[model samples]
Structure formats: structure tokens, C-alpha cells
Target: MREPVTELAGAGATTAEPLWRAATSARVRDLAWCTLAPPLLSAIPREFAALAEPGGAALASWPPGALAAWQRWLASADPDLLPPTIEELSALPGAVQALAPAARSLRLGRHAERLLHFALEHGEGIELVASNLPVRRHGPHGVQTLGELDFVWRDVARGGTGGAPQGQLVHWEMATKFYLLVEPEANVEAMAPDPCTRLQAFVGPNLVDRLGDKLSHILRRQLPLSRTTEAEALLGARVDRSEIYLLGWLFYRDGVMPAGLDALGLNPAHLRGWWSTLAQWAQRVEARSPGSPGSLDSPGSPGSLDSSGTSGTSGTSGTSGTSASASSVRWHRLPRARWLSPALVPEHETEPFETLHDALAARFAEPHRELAWRREAPVMVCEMEPAGASAPGWWRERSRGFVVPPGWEERARQRAVQPPRC
Candidate 1:
């Protein structure tokens, strides 16, 4: 009999709490998807092996964090959402293989959306109506492209489980945001019209991307697309229904919850990451990886690094697993798109550094790094050494989380908010 697909990568090894199993746990799996689904059409079921050429590397190279992000993205496919029932998720090898190609490019966030599209298309009773449809209006001056409809889909069975109707069309607006919490006091004066819109508390790494501005754009510019003549000409009908599929992760310093987080209306299932300053990161890494200055490496802690195993999944409740003195750990620079998810280190992917200083130096030197980490850094999940029984010294990522710098909240607030340029 053929073996089941156990992880995003191929399955030539034993299935002792594989990455797939870790990501599919009942809690995080469901939580991750709460904010992540969107409706799109269906496609032919191609063999898993067929995707090896165009998208194999993208799928195979998904770090632990990206997979976690993917899981959360899938979790967004809950029944109450606007999509049809994805009955094919349980098909194991076929489902994984079919979805693997959706992540053809290394763009992590885009891949998650592609998988969502694939999942919706793979549903039992769903059909693709349109995607990335352009809406342009011919004004007195000339034809102007108002905006693009992210996706337009129809559920052949109407809706999942509820049996709403048949051929129900939906306009889906899918988005992902990674914002850090800040004090509303900083911009209380600037928020003239509505001083207390929840947007005051959360801001992106760059202050320009405020929650208020996004909501304003969606409600004003995006939602109105249905009424435009351009959309009607393209879709042949007014969009019967519309919904926003907004998915995101919030980051904060370790053990420091923002003052007004509860009021933000953020979904409880929203994923989180911790941050630390470069100095703090150096201290933690050194503390965790015990050894001489030159020979720095921490051995694997006891017990299998499985969520269902004895350790019970670190970084979930804002904690981490124990450090192994002899095992080696690597500090990886997470992709900006994948920061909201876990960063998994496969056995072959563990490139340990000689010191914490070395890791930070290399990461900061990279051009186009997330500028938000100027004073603080985000630490992605790292695996403890002696990977699995099959591959020693090959540290496999076991969890998804980050550690942030101290006093970031204050610094975030001190930065002046930029006025929106019309």
C-alpha cells in the first residue's frame, strides 16, 4: 500500500509527529483559518507529482512558520464563511499534492491565498466565476481603472451546510495584515474625525498602513465596485453578495500585552508573534544555546518535539520549550510575508551560526529587510537539535512564534503618524 503524505515535503521517512501532524492539531489548525478563507472556482485534480516542476520548490521550502500560516489560512475556510464546503481536505496525499502547486511562487502570503483558491475550487459543489477581474470606467477625460475585484465566485450548491441557494455569487476581498500594537495616545489629536476608531491602537511596521485607512478604502472604494458599470459589464450581473476575507497576525513584545488589545475587535484566533531588541535577542540565544563563545550550540532537549508528545507545543501560550545544552540552534531571518506564521527548520535546512552576534549581523545586513526591526527584532521559531530520531543534528521546526524587543510599544507610539496624502 502507498504511504500517506505526512508533510509538505515528500514522505520517505517515518511519521512520528511529522510537520503535517504538528500543523493539523485541533486548536491552532482551526484558529489559523478563522481569518483566512475566500471563495473561488474549481479546477481539475492533477496528480501531486505533476506539480514538482513549477511549484515543488516553493512547497518543499515552506519554513515551519509559513506552514503554520498556511494552516491558519486554511482554518479560515470555516463553514460560516462565504465559501462552499471543501470536502477534499481529508483526501490526504491527493489534497496536499493538489494544493502544493498553489504555492508555486516563494511569495508566502500569495501562496496561502492560492491554496485557498485551490481549496475553494476543489469543493464538491463550487464553480469559478471570475478572478482578478478589472473594473474600469470611461470618464470625461478617459478610461480610468477604478480597481480590481480580487475574486468573484459562485457556489453551485448555494452555500456550505446551510443550503442557502444554488448559483450564489459572491465578491471576495482577501487581505493579510501584520500590525504591531501601539498606544492610542500618540495620535489622539491626529484622529480628528473619529479619535477612538480601533485603528488607533494597531499600526503596521511602517506607520503609514493604518487600520483606519484600510477600512476606509475597503468601505469607500472597494465595496462600491459592485455598483460600477465596469463590474456589471464584466460579470454580466450585479454581485449578488459580498464579503471581506481579512486574515492577519499581530506581533508584540514577549509577556507585554498592549494596553487596549481587547477592544481592537481582532478575532480571538488571530495568530501572534513576539519581538526583542538585537541586544535582547543576543542574550536569549546565548542563554538558550549554552557553550563556549566559539563552539556555540545547544543539543536537543529530552522528549520528541511533538505537540502531542510530552512537551505539549511551546510558543502557543506565550512560552517556549526547554533548551538542550549540547544541541545546535539556528536563528533564521523570516520572510516579511511569512512573519505571522511559524518558521520550520527541516533537518537539511539547519544552518547554525558560530554566535548570536554573527546571526544578527548577517540578518541586518540584508537589503529590504523589514525596517520595523531597526531597534527590535522578531525571532522566528527554531528547532532544538538532534532533529528527529531518523536525522540527528538536523533540527526540524517544532513550533510557530516570535520574540520581540523590549520597550517597543513606547517607541512605536513616539514615532509621528503620517498624514494620509489624498
Candidate 2:
């Protein structure tokens, strides 16, 4: 039960929100959240903990009081210290130049990278030295690329001389992942006995990525990249430390966490959500319909879905259980680029549950010519509620989850057991 490193601000908040959310631009809000959200895992799991040691692979450490600095900055009343205006951000670098609408097709990982790049360049106690620096070697045939360094920066707060950052140089590898837990067996008690083996059960929606494989790569390859002679020569400074910053949600089936997962070293406060096959989702929706018995709005339910579609015991954020009517609420399909922030949709843009279900069915049934890999891919859907008087004609995301096509779970189980192709 490791504590989260920072307090989170929900997306689509209007009033009494964090200062960063006050920005008028959607990109800015996403950037702020990406930079400040809690890491997916609190620390390297015990199985890989040895790789994080000083003589092995160095773990990332925040500069003294760095968290306090961010808290102060986020809470600052000074206009200059608040989140940068869109126009101001647009002028900073080419990485963010895509903040405009034209860059909507950018992958979520690249988008998060750009946002973190912005934070390191402008945020307190840090200085961005380089990003996406490639390491190459001249082979017998031609030049070959080994790998790229995600980020290298200086911790100015740790050691600075006359306001100039003269501190330990750090190499950081980051990833934004969304994995859904897969269970091959019907009986939970019959699951894998080994904790690391159990961790392999979390798989990406596309069935191409697994948590176990990713963790192994980060510990064995990515973190050690900075220590390579090729990387050191390119950086011009030996990396004093290396850290892995993993963020995003790990979704469970029907919003339920299996027992004995605490051994994985996952942060108890990590963002989470639920995943369901289309059939299961339809059943849940039918069960929660306005006239159904023991609906979601029923008194004294154990928990309700939050704006991010994660399960929460307290119904404070987004649409509360008692506030939103199941009949009137609509659903929105989240594009990959929009995954980072809680969605905000125009009232007219959303569709009824029936319409959404049909669309999903059509998508899953049809083979995509251009994207053959995505033919049966799971879709991320968000439940929406009216934004009230302050934001009339708009809707905000209340809860979100993944809806997979039939047989997707079996494929996911197969993929989970296979080694991740990093």
C-alpha cells in the first residue's frame, strides 16, 4: 500500500479545480495531468528490485523538496506561475507545435512524451538537457541504431551554483500504458502461484503488450542504455542516475481486483478502471437502466464509477450515482489522443447507448482494410452526463471502460502468457 506521490485532479473539472485545469486549452490540461499524475507502480517489484540498486540500475530520485515545489507552483495564485497559456505554450518548441488540432493523430505515448518534455523544460527545479537522443553504430553494411534515450536532465534543486543548475545528471525512461487484467481460468483460486507469473496476466487491449515483458525490458535494457559508452559519448556527461516513470491505468474485469495482487508492488493509489466484453457491458447497462431493480443509483451501493471510469467508494467527482439518470446519460468513444484527459464532449456529439452498441458491433464485425491489426481491437468508451448550468450544451465524462469484441478475452489470455515483443 505505497502512498501516491501526488494528489490528482480529475479531468473536465470546471470550478474549484487545480490551477492547471483552469487553462482554456485541452492540450494544456492534458499536459499538466501527464506531468503530475501518480506513477503506475510505486516501486520496482521485488522480483526486479535488485536491478534498481546503485551498482545495478539506478532508480530515479526526486530532488530534495521537489514535490513541495510542484505543490506550491500548482497552488500558486500568481498569474505568472499558473499553467501557461496556449499561445505561450505554442511558442516553446516543435514538439508542442503539434498541440494544434492537426496533431490529433499523434500516438498517446508520443503525446505524453511531448507533455513531459514541456514540464522538464519549464517546471521548477529541473532543466531539460536532451530528449529522444539516438545511439547508433556503424555496422559492416551501414549505420545501425541501437536505441534512443528518452530524456536526460539536471536536478537543479539538488545542486545549483548561483541559480545555474550544476547537479546530478539523470536519465529517465517513461511509458504510458493501459493494461487489462486477463484470467484464463474460471476459478480465481486456481490462478498462477508465482507473483511475477501472475503479473504476466495483465495485457494490452491490442494483445501485443504484456506487463511482465515491459518490466523486464525496462530493467534489463532501457535503464542500462544510458550507461553504454555510445550513450555517454553522445550525452557528454555520465548519467548519475536512471529512473523509470510508468503511468496509466490497469483495468480489471468488472471493476474487481483479484486477491493477492499486492505482491506486485503496484501502487495502491494507481489509477484504475474496468474492462468488459461487449456482452457483459450490455448486461451491466441493462441492469443499471433507470427502471431496473438495484440500479447503479440505488441507495447504499458499495461504489460508483468516477469521471475517469475508475471505481471509487466516494461518489464525489464526475456524475454521482444519485445525480445522473441512466436513461438520459450518453456514451462517447474515446480516441487514442483523448485518452489522457477525462473527456469533455459537446451535447450533440454523444449518442444513446443503443446507437453506441450498434456502432461497436459494426466495428468489431467488419474487418478494417487500412488497420487490419485493429479489426477486433477493444474500444474505450466513456459514460457522459450533462455539464450543468455552468457548461450548458456540453457533457462531461462520468465513467470510462473498455468494451472488447467476443472471444477477445481468450485471445488476450493467450497473449498474456506469451513473451512481450518489445
Candidate 3:
């Protein structure tokens, strides 16, 4: 407790591995193997309780208001809980505002606006919805044709929509661009239901949360959005803490976070591995409609697969009790596949694809070599004879696909036969 230990070494003084380590070193520096400097592990959720000292406030050397905000957040478990309307929150005593710098959401909202602008300018017809974005925020309102753009804008956020907006946006196209939007902590029905549907319910009396500002910024931006509203609507429903962590980590690790990720928090475990994060975004990209890949788009009216998703999950549900009763969870295991930027697939990541080669590999190689799992879907290559016999049964005969024609190869060679410009 002497000199307010800023790190583990100063706090522990005597280096020894923790036996049943739970309590932290007055400063919450984690006890690692052999007293190594922190490995940049993530902060546990809302455990800022670790920051308090009995009667004193958080950040003992800093502002008391921050501790107050942190404590209030801790009590709610949902940082955005009892969200004082934009009016109420903005008008808080300067003491509270001084404590929680995150409450200054002007920058956060502005960033969102920038995102919408960036997305709308991506290609053609993409729309960046303002907090007051139109249900039909596209085409004639500003569009001309395929691959051609229409419009975009930015403004302060307002009720549900209003806050000090970092910015605002609207677009006409469905392809080419995306918005990384943020949401409040408590709303559930408005957000997309996730893979672990049962675990994320923000209601009932017991739930935990994350660093709100950081979570909202990362998830809304890094994860990609079919449309700004997809996320906007979902935010009104539930909070996806893991997605927030993963997205925040992605931007932070890449140095895109406004002040850098370490400036706030770091948690690789909650965010999952880089491989998985890449996989998640890659899957989202692949899931977009088959409209052109380089522009803001109007995909024959969104939801043509191209309309895309703002939240990570689809909006509808299988509510029939009969269907639910008949449903059985069938789990299947497959090899993990490397994530591909779905938009950049085929041309960007070439593979020697042919049921012939893959089937051959699967029959003789291990499961991973033959079968690949992209997202939750399985893709196994296989070759089968006309006689209804498959060399590698695990490799589905359906995968036996066409090979690149020699004519295309010759054309490629001809195209490569260019005169050097000196």
C-alpha cells in the first residue's frame, strides 16, 4: 500500500507466484507466472470495483466523478442502464461528467457519422442512415444506376437517435460500404440475438457488462454493417459484450482506436482469438448479397442477401412451439477454415478447387485436410464416379466442380504477354 503501487513488481516487493491468487495488489495488477510485466490481458467486466479503496474514490489520484460513474455503472451491471435521456445525461453535474469522460459521446457519434460517410462513398447507391434516416434511404433520392452513388450526411445523435452525435449518415446502395454502429447496454429486443442466445439476455435482475464507450465504438465499427439501421435497431435490444470486445480489440490492435486500446481496456479472452475474429467478419462479408462488391449498393431492394445485416444475427425467429418441440440440436464437428475476406474471395484467395483433388485429399488425409468449416457451415470437397461411389465419402460428391478451362489459362497467358513500358 506504500507509494500506491502502479504495477505488480512495486506492489508484490517479494516475487512469489500466487497460490490462490484472487485479491489484487492494491492496484489490481494481475499476478502472472514469475512476475512478468502484464501480458496485456483484458480487464474483467465492470470490475472497476477493483479500483476503489473503501471510503476513497476510483483513480485515487484522479477525479472523484470518474469513480462515481464507474460505481454507478457497477451497480447497474449494464453501463447504459437507466440511460438518462441524452438531455439528462448531458446535463449531469460537471463533477460526474469530469469523472466519466466516456459520457462525452460527441466524438463517438461523430465517428459513426464518418463511418456512414465513408460507407456511402464506397461505391454506388449505399445509404448511411441519419438518426432520422428514411426507411427508403436510397435510389432516386440520390441514386442513378448500379455502381453509382446517391448521397450521405452526418449530424449530432438525438433521443434514441439524439446524443452529441459524433456524426450521422444515409445512403442509397446496399453494397460496397458499411457502418460500424454502437448501442446502449440494456435494450434487448432491438438488438440481434446472437449465437449464445440464452446467455446475453440483459434483463432479469442479474447481468454483467463492459466498458460502455469502448464496447460501443468497437463493435459498431469493426464488425461491418449491412446498413446503419440494422445495428441501430438491434442496439435498442441487447448488448453483445464479446462482439464489442472483439471489435474493440481489432481496432486497438490495428491502432485505429482514437486513443489506442490500451488507453482503456484489453481482453483477448472475451474477444476470442484473432483467427476467430477474422472468421466472424469474414463470415459477415460472405453473407452479403451477390450484388457488385466495390460500391455502395441498392441490392434489388435490400435483404436480397445483399441488403445485408446491421446486427450480427438475422432478425426473424422460429417461434412455432411445434417446430421448437420437434427441433433437436445436432452438433457436427469439422476442420476450422482460414477466414477469407468474403468480398475478396475467388480472385483474392485462389485455391486449386476441384472435387477431384479435395476428395482425394480427404479420403487419405486427416479430417482437417479434407473438410473445412467456415463460420458454422461445413465445406468438404469430394469426387464421385457416375457409379454412385465416392472415393471419400466425407467429401461430398456435390463439391466435385469444374476445373479452369485451358482456354482461360491461355487467355491469361496472352494477357500477361504485355510490352514493357519503358
Runs of candidate 2 with Cα error greater than 4 angstroms are: 1-24, 51-105, 137-144, 160-165, 291-322, 367-375, 419-422
- What does each candidate score in C-alpha RMSD? 13.0, 6.9, 25.8
Q: Give the higher-lDDT candidate: 1 or 3.
A: 1
- Work out how many backbone clashes candidate 3 has: 53
Residue lDDT tens for model 1, 1-422 = 11122332232213443322333222222223432221111111132112222321111011244345444444343323322112223334454455445333434455446645654554444566776667898889999998877767775645522455556666776666666656445443344343234454556665556654554455456656855678978887666565556666554443244433333344433444444455654564556435422111111121123333222212223224334343445545454533433433444455554554566555655556567464355445343344444433334444333434455445556542444311
Candidate 2: clashing residue pairs, number? 1
Best by TM-score: 2
Q: Write the per-residue lDDT of candidate 2 for residues 44-102, one digit (tens) a residue.
A: 76667554445545445556576556545444323333334333444465635545443
Per-model TM-score, in order, reads 0.58, 0.79, 0.17
Alpha-carbon lDDT, every model: 0.44, 0.65, 0.23
Ranking of models by lDDT: 2, 1, 3
Candidate 3 C-alpha error for residue 69, in Å: 30
lDDT of 3 by residue, 1-422 (tens): 12111222132322242211111221112111111111223432233322222221111011234323432322223212222222233456553464334234533232222222332233132223332122223455783322211222322221113433342232222111111111222233343332122112211100122223223322333223313344445333211111111221111111111212232343322111111122332343244334423111111211111212111112221112111111111111111121101111111122222323344334333346334322122222111111112111111111011112113223322322222111
